[model samples]
Target: MAGFIEKKALKKFSPGEIICLEGDAGNSMFIIKSGQVEVYNTVDRREIRLAKLGPGEIFGEMSLIDGRPRSATVRAITDVECVEITRAMFDKILAGSPNWLGVFMNVLVERLRIADKKQRVTDSVEIGKKTVYLISLMLEKEEKTTGIIYKQSWKKLVEDISFLLDIPPSQVSGILSKLIFTPLAESEFNYKDGKTFIVKDWERFLKFTRFCKERYLKNITKGIIEEFEVKSEKEVKFLKFINEILKEQARANDIEMEYMNSKCSEILNEDISKYEKVISELVKSGILKKAVRDDGGKYILVDLELFDIKFQKYVDIELFENILKKFEN
Candidate 1:
């Protein structure tokens, strides 16, 4: 069946090309002949994958069946070849077919619709990001009337988010309860107004969302088979030296690159010119962020708390998973 269909007007898409965008007007559906594509949608400014389609798979039929805007976006993962069957073309083909064939097609569309609906039941962390975004908007709205540092009542938060995201109030409250476990939340978030939730620094809470999503999406990204759970003895020693440097120095978060160059000589007890490789890897490992000094030299922006956890504790997948697991309503 697929071989016969491939003879139709075929469309070729290269990798990373968008075949269709979510919520766009889509008049046709795609039947994959070869390569791979991913169906995804953006939520909280992040793309959440819905499905992966390979040869002989179909997508975008929902738009044709219901005549609504496309529900999800599709992008080519590899060099892709697909036959785009328009709604009118499909109707014409089905018109010449047996009555049972149209029924079979309808059955396929209904099942796929249900599967896509299930995909939209996003995880709790995604909801947390959405919640933070909503709070930030509310803070801006209420900033003039509030005192220093914006905060919201738990009751208002639950009510608004439940209405905005169309989620139950209980689920929103569950996510908020776990939000306090985050690092920024530990210091800034406090129980007040008779157990009402309050976030002190609006910006810090915003970064918290990105921090969690960065780690969450890291697991979902494909072709990156490496894990930073364990390190070689040499790498561990280097991280220990950096940690000790941070500990001895009172203002250690902004250690200059030139300082690391000096430390390289001291630690190895030889004139090693610079130690750029491991520190660069630390940035990739999410243990450090790069910053710049006034003199135009680079520095490692160390989150002392996260540094201890990921570097000293040698964080494993299960540890971070447990943190996010708490937010799963």
Candidate 2:
């Protein structure tokens, strides 16, 4: 089986490369031939490291046996060579293995499912806090060569997290979206390459991550669902509309305040007064600001750096982009 896999289905990965992602449909398993791989899962925007597999260990067998989505993400910690074994190979191997190997595979799959379920129950806020700490660590490591990291760098960062924490890239992206809106990090989205820089403040950022982790853990242990005030639905809609306007039109800063208010009223099909209140709330939150122009006055959506810490929490990128396109036309 090993010889067959090596001859017909060898695969290679560079250091920091993703092998497979959690939740992805998979039909094959990988047997590590050289180097190392890490497995991890992301829950609630936080990555939980599962295990590190060195030479001769097998992964993706659960998917191959059950025909289910991958339970966790796997990434190469170093340059890795793998012998790929497909479902066809599994069928052939099962026939050859005395009934014992098949029994072991079934037992392993059941144990993995139980573990995955427990990991999934972790609080999202706790996971988010963990993600922030991981990102800060990555930024600290990269600070030597380049202080500024871009969007493309995020792909590499995701791979790094998968390798280090054993989490999937899709979950890393989700965690990143949350982190962007936090005070612990700052991002500018309008750069030429669409790269968002991670503001480095290692000490304070890590402190916050630790604080959040402890607080969330306490709440969960006490069976408390902590509650806090949140924006009204109308206010959320208004902010989203403004975010769309700023994103779709580069000249949003020059648009007159009155014009924006009128457009908001038109788009939302609500009274102008409602928009006025929403705008006032946005201004209070520092998401929007008044600017002086030679002719008169206008409102400008503040730069991404000044974005409210909670703004991205309410943002739906797909919905905002679709609305922005319609508004653009």
Candidate 3:
């Protein structure tokens, strides 16, 4: 069976060699014409055996179908001879046998089903981002409806948030419905396009999340990696926002440099510099300005207005200001 493979396609593997690992791009299928290969998965730092394959058995057949990750690790158990069928060959075979289209579809569908399990985790995070984004949009719509900001329709709002969050319109709608239930709920509008839920009191949501963030700021900083678990981008942005507020509050209170650091540590239960660095970068970028305190504080005075301008580019101004107020005490 191994000899059935074209000489050009026949590949050999040495014992103990890793033929492939999980999450690698699938490109080729292998038919073990000789020798043996072991399959395993790593979980909790332990190797769990899947199975072993010997002569005439095929591995990577699924890879040929879906072009997804290998899903498991395979290592050569002994010097081996295997026939490889690449994605190109798989397509060529399909072209010649359109009658097998249903077979290919079934294989691809099964691969997708397995892949969806991995995607559920990804989708949950995506849904979380969508939740944040929809809330942000709801704030804008509320501000406009109340004449605080420019007016925009719910359809347009959904479209904009969907594009920014990189999620489907349907997912955005589902999340928006949940968001509308809170004091954050503004107005509900149904149009030919779709339904939109707006936030009525932006301040309520802002203050609530801000209070939540501040009350948990200590725990948030300590267990942040576990709680309110945010992505690196959001974490960085949030840290920067908090740091700028701390700097401003320090300056306004005329707190000494040593005192501000101590105060920050007390409030967030963490050193201030982690956030200080982020503010320093913004200052360097001219997005934020810095001033020195005559009180002889080692920390730089971060300009809140400058910080607000920069942050407004990434998040809502009202939301930013509310989140920053958490550090005021």
Output candidate 3 Cα RMSD. Answer: 17.3
lDDT of 1 by residue, 3-35 (tens): 656676689999999999898997999989899
Q: What is the per-residue lDDT of model 2 for residues 1-329, given as tens digits with 9 covering 90 to 100?
A: 55666689999999989999999998999989899999987766876778999998999988998788998999999999998888887788799878988878878888888876655544444455566567766666663434443223666667777666555676667677656665545565554546454655555455555545554566667542222223577766776676677677763454566777678777877665666776677778676776877776755656565554445544533232232222211
lDDT of 1: 0.70
- Report the Cα lDDT for residue 192, model 2: 56
Which sections of candidate 1 miss by over 4 Å? Answer: 1-8, 99-104, 111-115, 122-329
lDDT of 3 by residue, 15-38 (tens): 999988877988998888889999
Highest TM-score: which candidate?
Answer: 1
Q: What TM-score number comes out for model 2?
A: 0.36
User: Judged by TM-score relative to the true structure, which candidate is superior, 1 or 3?
Assistant: 1
Of 2 and 3, the candidate ranking higher by lDDT: 2
Structural similarity to truth (TM-score) of each candidate: 0.38, 0.36, 0.33
**Weakest 10 consecutive residues of candidate 1 by summed lDDT:** 222-231
Candidate 1 residue pairs in backbone clash: none
Candidate order, lDDT descending:
1, 2, 3
Clashing residue pairs in all predictions, respectively, total 0, 3, 4
